[model samples]
Target chain A: AQKVTQAQTEISVVEKEDVTLDCVYETRDTTYYLFWYKQPPSGELVFLIRRNSFDEQNEISGRYSWNFQKSTSSFNFTITASQVVDSAVYFCALTPPIYNQGGKLIFGQGTELSVKP
Target chain B: EPEVTQTPSHQVTQMGQEVILRCVPISNHLYFYWYRQILGQKVEFLVSFYNNEISEKSEIFDDQFSVERPDGSNFTLKIRSTKLEDSAMYFCASSVTGIYNEQFFGPGTRLTVL
Candidate 1:
């Protein structure tokens, strides 16, 4: 079984503040991929980043960063100096290579982040 | 970059009616998929299609739901009988391959069963 859990349903932060969204995953497969997507008020999903299991390097892109830890089975995302436009529903996903064309993705419940200016 | 496209940003249909949602994937992509997200709920996978056939489906994808490519440029999802619970935002996605690739999604169609 492959599962991703996002315990925080909603979070609010003032503009320019930093926020970290937590993601915990459970999978029996040794090889897998992790992803983060953003869904704005428009209802369109935007792909943000993808990380493979072999890579545990913490990545930083612009004001966004991700931390992948195998020990904790966690992939956490951090937004530095978030702006109002950064407010969106963020989802954590896992893709295990064995099932369904090997392209199926298991998504978490998602965390709704609201940045107030 | 080319992105997947969907038709009718919003659709309103009565319960028990049949509805078809359409999608046009990126021209060079080979794998296609459909996913649905209900109000305040997590996005759920429905089905994946490749080689003009269904490669995989979730438990939610019942016999009432059918998918067809119809032509080289268009893919469609047909629901035999729409229920109130069928109301959701349906997203179409496509990937270059069906293995270990990122699947790009469309703007999605909001189906409202009244």
Candidate 2:
């Protein structure tokens, strides 16, 4: 079984500040995919990034970056110079390599981020 | 940009009534899924379908839940009976292949059971 945990239930940050959301996963499989999704107030899931187990390199997309560390079983997402629009509930999900057989994602409880001006 | 779409943004129904949630996955995508999130809870997976059959499902996807790709473009989830506990935001998603692919999501259908 695969499980994902996001310990931070809620976070508040001022505009232009940086924030990092922590995610930890447990999976016995050697290969898997990690995902970060954002659900805004309108309740739509937005795909952020997907990182596979073999790719431990940190990724940066504009102001968004992700750190994948296999040793700690953690995939952390960071937002630099965040704006108010970034306020939303962020979720971390895990999918095993043999997805067709057991592809259902194990999702974290999600972290609600509130960005104040 | 291509996206998965779901219909009937909100549906209200009485207990024991049957309801079907609809989705149109992105063209060329091969795998589809249904998930639910109760108020103030983590999203829960219900079922995944591919090649016109269920590939995987969770315990919550019991006998009452069924998924069908009735035509080439539409994927539907039917609930045999509605329960108060069944009220939640039902999301439909699709992926190009399998585990390695990103699952694109629809805006979701908010089902309200009365």
Candidate 3:
């Protein structure tokens, strides 16, 4: 079984401040995938990033970045110079690689982020 | 950009009634999935379908639930009998080939079982 945990239930920050949301996962499989998704107030999930376990390299996409640490079993997402649009519920998901069966996404409880101007 | 689409943005049904939710996955995608989220709760996986059959399903997907790719484009989820606990936002997603493929989700159908 694969499980993902996002410790922070809620976070608030002023616009332009940087924020990092924490995520930890547990999986016995040697190969797996980690993902970050954003659900805005409209209640639509938007895919953010996907990182395979083999690739520990950190990734940066415009204002968004992700750090994948295998030793700690953590995949954290950070937003730089956050704006009001960044206020949304962020979820971390895990997928086991052994079973190439239908792509199943085990999601976390999600972190609700609020950015104030 | 290509994306998945679901029908009936909101549906209100009485208890014990049957309901079917529809989805049109991306034209070129092969894998399809259904997930639901109750108010203030984490998203839960229900079922996954591929190659015109069910490939995997969660414990939550019991005999009461069924999925089918009726035609070339549509995928549908049917619930035998509605329950209050089933009232939630149901999402349909699709991905390309591999298990690691990033799934694209629809806006979701809000099912309200009365």
Strongest candidate by TM-score: 3
Off by over 4 Å in 3: none
User: lDDT tens digits, residues B1-114, model 2?
Assistant: 999999999999999999999999999999899999999899999999988899989999999999999999999999999899999999999998868688999999999999
> Weakest 10 consecutive residues, lDDT, candidate 2 chain B?
B95-104
**After superposing candidate 2, which stretches have Cα over 4 Å from the reference?**
A99-102
- Give model 2's docking category: medium
Q: What is the lDDT, from 0 to 100, of the residue B51 in candidate 3?
A: 89
Q: Report lDDT per candidate.
A: 0.93, 0.93, 0.94
* Candidate 1: regions farther than 4 A off: A98-102
Q: What is the TM-score of chain A alone in each candidate?
A: 0.96, 0.96, 0.97
Rank list by TM-score? 3, 2, 1
Clashing pairs in 1: none
lDDT of 1 by residue, A1-117 (tens): 889999999999999999999999999888888999999998899999999899999999999999999999999999999999999999999987745563877899999999999
lDDT of 1 by residue, B29-64 (tens): 999999999988999889999999998899999999
| Cα deviation of A44, candidate 3, in Å | 0.9
Residue B89, model 2: Cα distance from true site in angstroms = 0.3
Chain B TM-score of candidate 2 stands at: 0.99
Worst 10 residues of 3 chain A by lDDT: A95-104
